[model samples]
Target: AFKLNYSFEGISRTKPEQNLSGSSKKLTKDVLLQKTHEERRKRQEQRLKLQSAELLQSHIRSYIVRKHKKDQERQLFDEIETTAGIQVILSKLLFFYYPKEDRERLLRIAERLLNIQADVIQQINADKSFAWLIKRFLLLCLKNTKDNQDSMVLMKCLYVFTVDAHTFSYLVSKDYYGHLKRLLESSNNYLQETIVLIQKPFKFIHESDYLSNLVLSEFCTNFLIPSLTHNVKHILVPYIRNQRKEFPFEKLIRYLNTGFHFGKSHSLLYCTLELEPDDYEPNSDSIQVLSKLSANLYELKPTCDLTVEDSDDEEEEDPVSTEKRLLLSEYLKILNRSDKVRKWINFFLKHNHDESVLMAFTNLCHNLLLVYKDSMRKYLLLYKFGLSSTYLKRLWAYLNKNNTGQFETKISSFIAWREYHTTLSVFCDMFTFYTETLTDSETSDTSHTFTQNDLLSMSKLLKNVARGLIEVAFPMCRSSSIPSTPEVQHLYRACLNCVRMLYTLDLRKKFCPSGFWTSDKMHIPPDLARKDYLSKKISSFYGARNEEDEHLPPLSTIEQRSLAILEELPFLVNFNTRFLLLRDLCRNSLGEDDYQRLHHDLMHENVVAIRRTHIYEDAFDKISQKS
Candidate 1:
């Protein structure tokens, strides 16, 4: 019985152990599935967050773009409204206002409004009453001013009328000659405004045949010449009566100069003289008037001997005398075909020994020299070539004789500097003519040929001019005591550019020896070279100097100053010369590492690739109208 009970207990224990193993396996599977579900949920939340952030960024960008577009539209609409308001007010003032005083006052307000917004002028069109307003302004210019204030308002209105292209067109199309002639005849505060009106047609004459004919025939013949002769007689009559008042010299001179300038353009001077009837002969009265005026001008004492220094301080320019000279000079430009003008020229030529007459002749010739090509053949016929050449040489001698001195005063220095600059300008124009002639001869068929003697004469003149320029520039560059005012510097720079122009024309080769421009012999003094070298070496060893040092005037050492001068002289150096100069200048300055790196970059870089991207992007621009 005991053996049977032991067997049953062992069987029960085996069954319980098997059940525990099955339950543990089930728990392990459940835990693995729950961990997988948590990871999937987290991934889904991350994707949603990323999408929301992207949407928010897009919304911000769109809002900014819309705001900018709306602002631009608003600004444009505002400009349109403002323009419309201005146009309406101007129209009312011009059309509805009948009283002169009311019209003038309203015009001033309109002008101020126009000034406040420049776009109002630009937006003005001929289709509007602005055209009528322009005509009204021009008619007002004809009437005498009540006061200086009235004259100024009229002048400002005329200027505003001219500022719009369409308004100017309308202003010029009308015939105000009858009115202008009256204004020219009368002495009033409207001289400036009248001159402004007269100049408008002259300015646009080249663009319109009607305008050109009007100026040459109606304006010059009836208004300008008659008025000029009348005013001169008026002034001279007063002088003869021992009521020696200041002649209206400036006014007369301005009128004559304006006419001369207009005539000088398009060979209209000859036309002006020829504008008279086929049987037109100077009346006895005109000849007598011109004769008396010429005699009075010639009798003025010689003032040419005034030294540059003395002239700057002591000799205030005699307006009467200077204007007299200028008037005589202008008469030289008149065609000799007219009996009165011919008599005037011959009278002055006979009295050429008179200091005033000679000065006038010189001044005219100097002006002619600068524009020689333009007036050369005409003047050659007028003076005969040899006489004209002699006049120019005599003028050159006179300029050189007076071109003296170390001036202590600013005014004197400026005066002396200007004279030198004029001398350089005259030569620059001469060289420019020479270059043009050569270029034309090479590029096209031409009848005129430059002789060897002509070339030699020009070369000699250029060298002499260059030497004079060097004399001026070298001292100014070397002297640290010279005032570096902008005007002085500008004159200096202009002089240097003239020299560079000479070099550009290949005239420098004839004058400046090749050895002169060598890098080693750049006109730097030995001490200056040493100082530059020492400064550079010290700078390299001590790292860069303070930023304040950079702002100091670059004209320190001769080499540094020369570099500064060269940098400013864009006219002097062409591309190849500029590159060579830069290379030579920077050669010893760059470090070996920097140089190598730059070289490597330049050699390895693909310029075409870099340029290609920009080229393709720019190839089909939607806004460009160009084919």
Candidate 2:
């Protein structure tokens, strides 16, 4: 039924109904109330629909924007990775473009991109076209054509490049060394520092390749050694020790070299080098360089042997122990070979050009002569035919000739051409652990091998040096060319005593009925084995007792060479004369901290020596002086 009802609105609602105005009005109201609820529901639905439509529109817009942004980044990465390489990307960054915000962003991205293909690196190096591109990029990266200024591009490139070895190998293969060398001469400290870090991998690259070998040889000969002759201090001591961490490894390598140490330690004092390189030019500014490194050169004190008091007697000190002897022996073990001896002599001769350096050599010589107290003379006799006392005397005179700027030698220097040529001709053979130590059964088959012949030759050489030093020091029988005081005579005699005592052990075989010569190897002369030197004097020593004093056997030049080689034998396996410089250096320069550490190591080295050869008695006092 339809009903109509009165409302606030002028119209009443009716739906197919007939009713009276008064009574029907009540009935209509009930009908209208039921319909009213349906109307309210329709209105609420409309409002909710409008709200949902607004929300859907907003989300769709946001999602489309995000997709576009990601697509742009992906496309940017693809374009850069495909059309061009990272180097191109880096090229866009010129030194002048110092956009702080953008620079930070690029730096972060480059840092994060650590891994790169080695094949790409190889290809880039193989392609010479890349060279032009690289040159242009670097030149552009520089801020200006003049005035020292930092290059962010240089810093960034190296920082990125040195991530690994292949990266460095690639850069080096491209012949970056030439440019790098040029850069090293620059006044800019940062450039030098950055280059140093980059060069670290070069150490590995130089290990096996022939080209690297050639490079190193040339570098040492032309650049390094020449630089040293003139400016050894510049090469050795950092211009600023206070800020040594600032200098590169390359500079340190110069100072770390052998020649530098020889001069700094002993050249100022009176001693001369036996060796001089083929081309040596001392820098005119050497004095200036020395001043820069060591302001108080005179203040530098000499090393003094440390004395530890014995517990048994308050005044007396314990003598060097067997363990100490062993350690010293082991230290010398490295020096036992012919190659090492040759190298030692070569190095000794070259550095011995200066007085201070010569003194260092003497210290080493003393160590060599003293190590095998009893066997030195036998070894000396083994090769005395080739080695000469005159040569040693000449060496000593050259060393002692130079005073502290007060006096210098007037005599012309002599370079042994034969010795020099012989040295230059053969490559130094690498030593073996067993061959050097006399423990390894497998010996290196090379030009230089430690054998009976070597023992004979080197023994002779060492003896010449020892006897020569004594003669020069005392001139008891020989006329004194050098100053000889009573004290000097005593020292010289003591040194002679050391040699004589050791000879007593081997000589006892003749004086004693029992044959003291243990191995027949020691008895053979070099002239018989290898014909190293023609020695006639040894025949008399080999002759009867009456023949020994009556006609003194003068070692021929060749025989003297043999003796010189032999004298250095005891020092072969246990200690090196070279180490004496290092030792004496410690004596003077090493503070308590270094002294304790080095002293401990030395003690350990000595202990090792004693284990190999025990009771190495000072035979000169007991045997040589007796007669």
Candidate 3:
């Protein structure tokens, strides 16, 4: 059924008219109500749709606000990062040009870039460009004014950070040393402060070959030596003490040799040399380095000339010269620690290149004799015969310079050469007697006892050798001019003792009844004793004998005369006299059974005596001189 609805001012519509009964009327009304309900429900749905639209609009606005805020925040962050980067670049540039003004800011930047406490070294290795920048800034700080605390603080930071061996090379380069020298030279106080700063941290630079070489170059002869001489207590002592940290001695040696071709040697203080045995291996780089260092040290002459003003002058002396700041004696005070003096001498002599250098070194050693006599004597003996008798010649020349001292008598007499030649003649005679005795032994090979001719020959050789040795004694005791000096006296005594040992060896048979001498008496000429000058000198020289020595067994006339002669030449006394005496007795004895003992004795005595007197002699001198 179609239902018709009526509005107040509008027309109502009916789809169709069917029946006008009760059922029709009720159905029409129900349709009208359903239509009304449908309209109201549609309105409610529209209202809900409007509310949903409003909620969505609000959400969109909120999203836009939040996104805008985030964008603004991002923009601000970008600006801050850009400003920081610009600040760093500007600070670096300003510090590079005007370090004293912007030092603090640049230093902070450098610290951040180069000094991350835990990973700083790693960072330095990873960022090459940043490291370069840091390096440039560091140098700027170093080049700043002496009074700038910022520079000092930057240096402290640098020292702390660059101590790492892995990164040290990155912080400094070969060119930096020159900058350091220029910076430090302006003020002595600044120089000392710089040294102090570098000194403590130097211990940590254990590796980095490039840095090692640079450090050595920076502290080369010209720069460090002058500093060292002027400030030994403050500079040199600390540097040497730091050698315990594996300092680059090898590089130091190379630096010393760089200018050696022009006769310009490295100014190496003896204190600076930390030479080890490991530095002296054959055909090694270290050996070459060591040789070079030795040459440099030997040839090094002080650049600053020190003049001695006449005592009569009343003017004040000038400030001490760099060369004269530290004397050779002061150097010796340090070198004496490891017997370095001996090592230095041997090294120079072994690699002999310049005679003038050798002469200078020899002269310096001669001067040491007064203070270090015992050690000097041993050193002299080491070169006495070796190096073509160079040491002997030097010694002789030194002795000839002075006419005073204990050796005045001998030098005045000029009889040492004569006595030496005479002794040589006697030694030849003794050798002839030995050969003759040996010949007789061959003939009487079956006999355990000596023949009459063999014994007579030995006895004659012994007497002649003893007399000749006594003559040699006179000159040796009289030759050294510096008698009051213990060193001169000691050397004189050593030589004289060597002679006495040989003499005693020749006269052993008489002293101990070897039975080689036919009688206890030797036909020593009374005329030999007539020259009482040597005798009285002998007595005065040795001084009064101890009372205990007087109680010994009475000596034969020949023995007494030899003893009297030995007393005048106190320098001739040696502890090895008995060994020498016994060995000679065995060598000349006719008994074949004693040959082995004689050879053994001679070998032992030769080793000990040679060390004292003739070990360093040339082979020809050792063989020909006989003593």
Top candidate when judged by TM-score against the true structure: 3
Better lDDT candidate (2, 3):
3
Against the hidden true structure, what lDDT does model 2 obtain?
0.36
lDDT of 2 by residue, 308-386 (tens): 4446766533343433443344334433434435544555445545554444443333323333323233223212211
Better-scoring candidate (lDDT), 1 or 2: 1
TM-score for each predicted model, relative to the true structure = 0.29, 0.26, 0.37
Give stretches of model 2 more than 4 Å off.
1-127, 133-153, 159-196, 199-211, 214-471, 474-495, 502-627
Model 1 scores a C-alpha lDDT of 0.44
Q: Please provide, for model 3 over 1-627, each residue's C-alpha lDDT reduced to its tens digit, 9 standing for 90 to 100.
A: 999998698667857756755463345888999999999999999999999999999999988986676556544544553366633453335433433344455555555554454465465567766556556555665565354555566666556545355444544453444555555555554566566544543454445555665555545533544434444445645654555445545445555445333233334434344333324322223334434433333222234333654668787544443344444445455545445545555655564454444444443333333233233323332232223333433333332333133232244443544333222222232233333343344432101233334334434443443444343333333344223433234334433443444334334223323443223333333233322312232322233234433434433334444555445332233434434544444444435666777667777884533354444333432333233
Q: What is the lDDT of residue 567 in candidate 2?
A: 40
Worst 10 residues of 3 by lDDT: 531-540
Model 1 segments more than 4 A misplaced? 1-424, 437-498, 507-521, 525-554, 557-561, 568-581, 584-594, 598-627
For model 1, the run of ten residues with the poorest summed lDDT: 536-545
